[model samples]
Target: MFQQKSYQTQVSGTLYLVPTPIGNLDDMTLRSCKLLKECDLIASEDTRNTQKLLNHIDSQVPQMSLHEHNYRERVPQLIKLLKDGKTIAQVSDAGMPSISDPGHELVVACIQEQIPVVAVPGPTAGLTALIASGLTPQPHYFYGFLPRKKKKQVEELQKLADQVATLIFYESPYRVAATLEAMRMVFGGERQVVICRELTKIHEEYIRGSIDELCEYLQETVLKGECCLLVAGKLEEEPILAEYSLEDGLEMIATRVAAGTKATKAIKEVAKETGLSRQELYSAYHQEE
Candidate 1:
C-alpha cells in the first residue's frame, strides 16, 4: 500500500533491483551498469559469477553473497544497511533479481520498513523466448522451474490443465526432455510447444513443434544451457450444438425416448448433451413436421 517514487529524496538509502544479462553481456542495460557501479554494496546470488559481470562493466563495487542458502540471514543485514542510508543493489547471476532468483525476501523486508526500492528493466529468458515462440503474446503465465520430482511435477501440471493463457516455464537442459514428455502426457501430444535454449548466446536455438514431436526430437539432440519452454493454451471451441442441425437433434431426442426414456427426460438429456436450449428443443419437438 506504500507509494514508491524511486527518484524522490529520502532519508533511508534505496534498494535497487538490477537486471543482468541472461547470456550476452551486450544485453546489460545502461541504468543497470550505472546503479551497480554507484551502489554502496552489491548483494549477489554468486559473488564469483557476478565478479565476471563486474569485470566486464569495470565496476569494483564490494559484493557479498546473498543467494538461496543465505538470503534469509542476509535480509536483516541488508535492511539494516538501508536504514543506515547505505544504498544497496541486488543482482542474480543473470536476468532480473527476485525473479526465479534471490532478492524477493529482501525486497519484502525493505517494503515493510518503508525503504525505497527501484527496479531497472532488462532482458529475461521467458519473455525473450515468448515473442519468438509464435504463440499468442498478451495472455501468458510464467511458471519458473517446475518441481523436480515426477509425481510432484504431474500434480502441478494437472492444476494448469485448463489454463487458457499461454504457459511459460524455465527448465534445466538435463531435465528438458523429461519435462516435455510429462507436459505431453498432461497437455496432450497435439499441443504446440517451443523449446528455447542458450537464449542470447551464440548457441541459442528455438525448437518448435507439437509436444510429441519435440519429445521425440530431444531424445537424439543433446541440449545445453538454460531452457525456456512455451506452450500454447487450450483452444476454445464452440459447443457441440454448433454442429448439430435441428433435424439431427430431434432424431437424437426421438432415439432416447424410444429406448424407454420419458419424452421430457429425452428432450432434457439431448438438450444438455448438444448444448441446445431446453425450450428450443421442446418447441421444436412439439412443432409440426
Candidate 2:
C-alpha cells in the first residue's frame, strides 16, 4: 500500500522570490504585499530589515533569517515544509534578491527538488537607474558593483570601454568618486555619463554630463544614498582607408606633424579623418618630403 500525493490547487509549498524597494516604500507592489501576507513562511535576508517592512503591511507571517551565511543550512528545512505543502516567501533586505545580495543558492536548490518557483516582481535599482538616465535603451550591460580593488575595477571597465551600449553600475557613496575616475580613464573625458543618486527618495537627484564634468561635480558636492552610474556607449569606429585622395592624405600628415602631433598617432588620426591607410599616408608623406 502507498500513500497518495495531495493535489491541492493553492500551490502547496511554493517558493516566492520577492523584490523589495531600493529606497522608497511606495515602490512596493500590491501583489508583493498579498503574496507576502499569504505565504506560510517568510525567509528574509535580514530579519531586522524585514521586520520594519512587515510592520508597515500589518502582517504577522512568521519570519526567519535566510541570508548568504545561512542559506545552505536553511534550504533543506524550507524544502521540507514545501514537501509538506507549505508556501514559502523569500525576500532580501532591499532591491531584488540574488542581485548582488543573496538567495540564488536557495532558488537553485528548490528547482533541484522539483519545487514550484514563483516571482513577485517589484522595484530594481539597476532598471530604475537605466530607465531614468535617458541613455540609449538597447544594448546595455549591468555590472552589479565593481570590485573594491583599483586594478580589478580598471580591468573590468576597460573591457567594456569599446562597447556600443549604455553601461550601468551600482556603487556606494565612498567609492563613487574613485569608480568615476577609473571610468574616465577607460572611457575618456568626453564620454556622456549620468549619476543617479538616492532614487525614489526625497534627496534623489540626477546629474548628467561628460565623464570630466561628472568627476568635477562629485568633487564639489557631497554624495549620499545608493547610486547607479550610467555611461553612454562608444561611437561606431569609422573604417580607415576609405576617404580622401593620396594628396589629401599627405596634406593632413604634414598639418598634424607641424602641430607637434606624434607621427604614429597623427598618421592614425589622419587615417581616421581621411579614410586613408596609415601605411599609405606614411609612404606618401615620405615621398613628398
Candidate 3:
C-alpha cells in the first residue's frame, strides 16, 4: 500500500507503462513517443517487433527484451536500475502492455518498491474492437485469451455462461473457427457474436451475426491476423413458471422425472426455473400426491 503522486518530484527513477498502437502506427500517442524517447531504457515484450515501431517513430532509445519467458529473470535487474534512479519504459509488441501481454510482474515490483509508476494511455485491442463490434459498451468483460486446450476452453466458457455483461475474448486466426464452434455449443447457436479481425489495419473486417452464422462462415473463409470476439450477454427474463399455474409446474416436473431425472433433482430444477421456493414445491407436490 503506497501513495503515488506521479508528477511530483521524487528521489527514485520512474517506471512508465506505455501503450503502443494495436495496428495503425498513427495510433501511438505523442506522450508515449516522448516517454519512449526520454526514458533511460525500454523493456519490450519482443525487441525485434518493438524495434520496427521505434524505427518508425525515429526513436533511438536502447531496449532490452522482457517477455513472459524472461520477465522473472529480468524483473530484479530492472528494479535495480530503478533503484539507481534510471527511468524505464515498458512496452508490449502491440496494444497495451499486460492486457494479455507482459508487464504485470514488473509493475507489481515497482509498486512494492514504492517506485513512481506512470501510465501513458494509448490504444488497446480489446476496447478498440468492442466499440466497433456494436455490442454493449459500458458493461464488458475482457477475457484476453481462452485456454488453448479444447476441454479447458469449454470449461472456462461454462463458467461464464451466465454472465450478463458483454463477453470479450482474443483468439489466434487458426483457432478462431474452433473457438467460435465451442462458444456456440456452450452459449447456444442463436447467441449474437461479433468477430473483429486485423483490427486497425488496411484489411480489417468485422463479421457480426448469430453464433451459428459465424461458425458456418468461418468454415468457408480463412481468417488472417489475431481476432477479438464479442458475445452478447445472457438475456434477463421472467422465470419459466412466471406464466404457468401450479398444476402446470407439477406436470413439467413429473415429465422430467419420467424422463430419468431423479425426483428430487427434477423438483429442484422446476423450482429454479419457475422461481418458486424448493421447500414450497416439495410440500405442494407431496400434498397433491
Q: 1 or 2: which has the higher TM-score?
A: 1
Off by over 4 Å in 2: 1-12, 239-271, 278-289
Cα error, candidate 1, residue 101 (Å):
1.0
lDDT of 1: 0.91
Instruction: Give the TM-score (vs. native) of candidate 1.
Output: 0.84
Q: Candidate 3 — which residues are off by over 4 angstroms? A: 238-289
lDDT of 2 by residue, 1-289 (tens): 3232424354447888899888888788998998888999999999899989989888789997887788778988888898898888899988888888888988888778777777777888888888889998688888889999999999998899889989988899889999999998888899999889888888889999999998998898878888898999998876664557988877777788999988878878887787678898888777776
How much is 230 displaced in model 1, in angstroms?
0.7
| C-alpha RMSD for every candidate | 5.8, 4.9, 6.3
Which lDDT tens digits does candidate 1 get at residues 100-176? 99789999899999999898899888999999989998899999999999999999999998988899999999999
Model 1 misplacement above 4 A: 239-289
Cα-based TM-score, every candidate: 0.84, 0.82, 0.83
* Best TM-score among the predictions, by candidate number: 1
Each model's lDDT comes to 0.91, 0.85, 0.91
Q: What TM-score does candidate 2 reach?
A: 0.82
Which of 2 and 3 is the better model by TM-score? 3
lDDT of 3 by residue, 1-289 (tens): 6999999988899999999888899998889999888889999999999999999999999999999899889999999999999999999999888899988999999999999998888898888899988888878988989999999999999999999899999999999999999998899999899999899999999999999999999889998899999999887786463566677778988899789998799898988787777887788888877
